[model samples]
Target: MSPYSPVAEPPPRVAARLRRPRRPRRGSALVRRAASPVALLVLWQLASATGVLSPDKLAPPAQILRAMVEEWHKGTLQAATGVSLQRVVIGFALGAVVAVVLAVVAGLSRIGDDTVDPPMQMLRTVPHLGLLPLLVLWLGIDEAPKIALIALGVTFPLYVNTVAGIRGVDRKLVETAGVLGLSWWGRLRHVVAPGALPSFLVGLRLSLGVAWLSLIVAEQINATSGIGYLVTDAASFGRTDVVVGGLIVYSLLGLATDAAVRLIERKALAWRLA
Candidate 1:
């Protein structure tokens, strides 16, 4: 070999071929996701303008927007939203905390599982709406019953998912932790919880949705307040525009809650993403 000769470099074309495509920025991805909703708005406007759909029955999207603004100005929207959100947060937090504790215990201990699992499974099968009358009778047509109903609605999803998550912890990981002289608590902290996080997040999201739905049903009973009350009142009076506006508010609230949970999940489980 000639001492002065340099090693051959890969061709620029070959180097370029090995590079991956640049991903779109996060903001761009969000904008792309938003496009469909904007398109739907435009289509709604066109349909309403051409009288293709009966505005009296369905109420044009523009009219619904106007109603929403009017309701906001009247302070009814804000009050209703506040009451609904308060109930959801209070009930969901309590339910989720209790469920997590119970689930973790049941998942870890055969005695705990046998004692709690069967009853929980049966309770999960009971339709929430069917329990409303009984709940109202027992707890009264007040915040108590409403909050209880929401708690019950939110609990099962979290409990079931949590149990599944704990049970799904990898056997090999557990064995490795055992070989490393890790205690049961250490194994759980290092291996089990992290393994279960994705499923737990999913359960959190699902439970949030159920919380809102249950609150709506709960609030419909003798409620002179809340978004559910507004919707039911508007519906009774055949005020389709107001009803639609209330529904839009509920949807926005649910979306906001889910988004918040997803953000927390992403932060907490950053390692899982890798």
Candidate 2:
């Protein structure tokens, strides 16, 4: 070829076809997502004003907002929320620890898997609330039973998911690690765990939801304290506003916990996200 040869450029249409539009900004995306909720709020206000629903049976959204504000000012809401959060935190931590240990053991050894997996699978089928009576009888009506109930409800999801994740790790990757002279611990740490992380995070999210539900059920049982107690107590006394407020609080708390866990997952699995 000649050293000074000239090259032809592609047509403008061909060049243009290769490009993609930039995505909308994050702030714009958030505003677009928020429109539905804002519209619903306005619709609710209109319904309340028009008497479309009985205000006595279902307090207006405005009244619920006012009750929430009043409870916040009185500090009762904060105290109750704090107590419920503490119970969830403690119970979730205990359940996650035990589940991870069991999952790791079951994933590694055939005997351990055979021994633990059958009972775990069987227990997973039982509704968590069905165990409340037995738990209460065995552990009593104190915090122990409540915590145990939450732990039991939360454990199986994590255990099953984690075990499945470990087992689903790619055999090719494991073999590659072996060929690279990795030890068993090194192979697990670098290959298996990272591969399993997405499933593990899914399990964590499921377990957190179960923990919240179990806490609500546990708190409903003769609880002298907690947000659940506050809701049930308010319901019994015909304070529907307070009951609705308690529900609102629980919804917010659950949203907050889920958001936190999602953030953790995103951070921990940045590679996977990419």
Candidate 3:
């Protein structure tokens, strides 16, 4: 070895310092995430007070908060939220069952793929909004139409993601399973389900969002209750504060549901992360 090398090693302490991973800032990430929204509310309140933004056009955050409290006291907010949550839960459950069944059928067999995929592909392209009038005509201006719309909206994304997930499972792993004398059901239970789970969860998040959106649309026409009904009723009465409060309710509900799904994912997919 040459006595004088082109490069020299750093001291162990210096090298250790260079290799150390930077620690994240010490604080709750949730607080950091909330900073932007809190700042926006402050700006909105300032603008409303300064007359830079008209309360007639957009109610101040303070007014909206007051109106929300009043609605809660009167039981309107609680009732409307309950009804909306019930509708979403029922519709989502039904849609999830249907989507998983369809995905499994199509993903597992050529015959099923040919029979089920074509129709599904055709139907997914038809906007769910356009179906509202038709659904009302077919099912009447009742909870049935609203629930059906939400179910339809929740179905497609899950089906697509689940099917893709199953098909995307490693062919080599599948072959190995077969060579190991595993039955079809054994292969599916042991090898396929876990592989497909991540994609299915992604689909679940998308479906939940669509379910909320569909509920919003469905509640717009012939809706006697829900956050959407509250907004529409407020609009008719020219109560900007109530209207804004209803919208805030919808936003908060959406965030809460998404957070729930994320919690589920964190727990269910912990193995994958490991």
Candidate 4:
């Protein structure tokens, strides 16, 4: 056979097909998502206008919106929002730090597990809200009790989730780290922390929800300025619109924080998308 007869030519290369441009469905998607809430607002307005629902007992959405605007212009909304945000931020930070420290210690050592876990588990059994009177007596009617209540509410969910995540780290990965002569900190940084992140973020979201709930209750007691105080003052004046406005503010804040955390989780846990 001739040497030239032996070779077969490879198939010719093909260019990649162009991708179709994506249609912008954002407006439609947003409208769909907002449909229910908008319909509810319309229903509320209709009910109030037709006298089917008393505006005194339950404010119409229009009245509530007007009250919200009025409060905003008076700076009462701003002030109350600031105070409430401050309490939540401080309490959430303290609770998170303590929970992480405790969880890490317990997860890393048997002695720490034995020493810290039992007492925390015991404390978790107590209804934190029931401590309102004790908290008032101990910490007074100041920001201390309010923030402390938020802290207490923020702690348990975080602690439980963190401990579970840490303990749930794969034994094989830990052993492999040791086999590779990685230090404890190195192993934790590379292996444990990443594995535990999803659980930790879930806990963060739950803790945020609980923190807001605790803030509402705590602020109701001797609150000088907060959404809770605003609601209380409005209630005394029989201003249902203001009360509804304050509650809507609380609900929106909770939803916003939850969304923020979910965004963080999506970014941090993008590997799971694979």
Give the number of the best model, judged by lDDT.
Answer: 3
- Measured on C-alpha atoms, candidate 2 has an lDDT of 0.83
* Highest TM-score model number: 4
lDDT digits (tens) for residues 170-190 of candidate 2: 989999999999999999999
lDDT of 1: 0.83
State the displacement of the C-alpha of residue 211, model 1, in Å, after optimal TM-score superposition.
Answer: 1.0
Per-residue lDDT of candidate 4, residues 7-114 (tens digit): 221111111124455477656877888999899989889999999999779988888899999999999999999889999999889888888999888877899999
Between prediction 2 and prediction 4, which has the larger TM-score? 4
Full-model lDDT, candidate 4: 0.84
Against the true structure, candidate 4 reaches a TM-score of 0.87
Cα lDDT listed for each candidate:
0.83, 0.83, 0.86, 0.84
- Candidate 2 residue 56 Cα shift, in angstroms, is 3.0
Clashes of 2: 0
Candidate 3 lDDT by residue in tens digits, 1-274: 1111212233234565788775688998899889999999999999999999887799899999999999999999999999999999998898999999999999999999999999999999988768999999999998999999999988998899899989999989999999999999999998899889878877887888888888988999999988889999999988899998887787778878877776787787787655
- Candidates in order, TM-scores: namely 0.80, 0.84, 0.85, 0.87
- Candidate 4: segments with Cα more than 4 A from true spot: 1-33
Could you tell me which residue pairs clash in candidate 4?
A: none
Candidate 4 residue 189 C-alpha distance from true site, Å: 1.0
**After superposition, candidate 1 runs with Cα above 4 Å error:** 1-56, 179-181
